[model samples]
Target: MHQLRTRPARRLVQLYAGLVLYGLSMALLVRSGLGVMPWDVLHQGLARQLGWSLGTVTIVVGALVLLAWVPLRERPGLGTVSNVVVIGLALDAALAVLPEPSALPIRVALVPLAIGLNAVATAAYIGVHLGPGPRDGLMTGLVRRSGRSVRLVRTSIEVAVVALGWLLGGTLGVATVLYALAIGPLVHALLPRLSVEVPAARAVQPVS
Candidate 1:
């Protein structure tokens, strides 16, 4: 809705690049050995429980979330399906390379970088306007269908998710709190700057 990064190819590049960055950020946050994003907490828990890689769990969960969209009558766009695939592969790839530091200070340092990068990634993907992440779609759908405020719907879902994740042995720490408080503001600030205006559909002209 802002500046036109009008080239379709560029938008495609942005979409995939943003997705990769988003996955890398998630991996970094998890490696910090602190809390992760709300949905990722569940992913991590399931990963541990099922003896699967975190990225594998993430993809499965994403698919299931997409399935939930059916009841809400929400359609999956190219970005949505790509979000389910590219991010998981990218996450696992990053996790393979990122270290698990036992030292507190090193782990602590990753927090800001991970969170900031995640925000940038989120903005980049969302700015292209192809579609929302599955979790985001779920929240928006619930808000529309239930007549609840976005705040209420999002918070309720996150709280429940976090609770389940914690019970299932996922980490929950200050980083989780930091992510919750900061992400919305970060995305809000960055989206406009990153946004690539979509070209309007061309109108049909009458035959001469």
Candidate 2:
């Protein structure tokens, strides 16, 4: 709340920017013809199976994930709703403009770039502390209710998703493995540096 109440402009900008950049990062990985983020593996697989655009699949999946929150009693905030909408739109926009490269060197190089962008994007939105994205909330809620360790719960969920996505024909390459290895440390390093701290409210003095 203090965050919601004060310095509204910067937080909103950071939230939307981060969401858009997140989508762009997803697009870059997809275009690289290498691999994508974990949730995106599921989205891309669904799109291929369904003959839909990747962005459309992302939006639908995000909406569905948000719905899962209802059963978990997780609350959504402005950033959460915006995350569902804006990332999909941004993905579509970026993909429409970006040309998929054929060169192996360029494609391989995109992996690290995309990973770094993803980390910065993640730190920006999460640092705002407005709300967790739907997927993240689901993981936390499951952990809370199931009494599972965060590591176990998150790993189980991601492993299930990746296995399903791979079965459904999503790309799983060295890039996916690299992303898995690097993302944790990258965000860990970037979050504190990027987090937007809302200052405490000033106390009012009694009337003289």
Candidate 3:
């Protein structure tokens, strides 16, 4: 998109803000104790196993995911690399400040709120079109290589991750299932509205 290239400041702002909010949303979900998204399940499990901070596990996992990109021929962009670092740092920061609520009802309420916020954050960063995060790029790459439906590839990948993470001692709860069901529709609804449109001339350019 021309706007993406030309309005670097706005795009950067959107990218960073989206990433920060994404991390915060993850923290919210963690504090809720309702479980987390698929990749996060793995992160949490690794954190527990290694006795490391969740954010540390997140960054490590992100880097490892990026390593998988090599065989897939997935190129990392500024946003992609930033995603590996910023989200982890932000999550740590958020977790540091946010207290875990004692009330069950309050914890329950955080689930939907975290899910909604995560969707918005996802759309915001993706709309910038700088690049897909490592996990997302892995999904797209697999779909390309295997010639499978996005739904099939994504579901298969997630199912495997959740299973492995659960086995590794991650929290698997109703929220995990709920988030899987809800995020697709929410991102679909939000992406068009959130996406930054390119000028007509730039629309025809080859996407990098």
Model 1, which residues run further than 4 Å from truth?
A: 1-6, 199-208
Task: Give one digit per residue, the lDDT tens place, for model 1 in 1-208.
Answer: 2222456777788889999999999998999988898888888888889999989989999999999999998766677888999999999999999879999999999999999999999988887777788888888888889999989999999999989988888888889999999998998888889877675442111001
| Model 2 TM-score on a 0 to 1 scale | 0.92
Predicted candidate 2 versus true structure: per-residue lDDT over 1-208, tens digit per residue: 4446756788889989999999999999998998888878888899999999999998999899999988888777777888899999999999999999999999988889999999999888887767778788888878878998988988899988888998898988778888988988999999888777765342111000
Best candidate according to lDDT: 3
The segments of candidate 3 whose C-alpha lies over 4 angstroms from its true place after superposition are 1-4, 199-208
TM-score of each: 0.92, 0.92, 0.92
Residue 43 error, candidate 1, Å: 0.6
Q: Evaluate model 3: give its lDDT.
A: 0.86
lDDT of 3 at 140: 82
Candidate 2 local Cα displacement, residue 5, angstroms: 1.5
Q: Which window of ten consecutive residues has the lowest lDDT sum in model 3?
A: 199-208
For model 3, what is the alpha-carbon lDDT of residue 23? 97
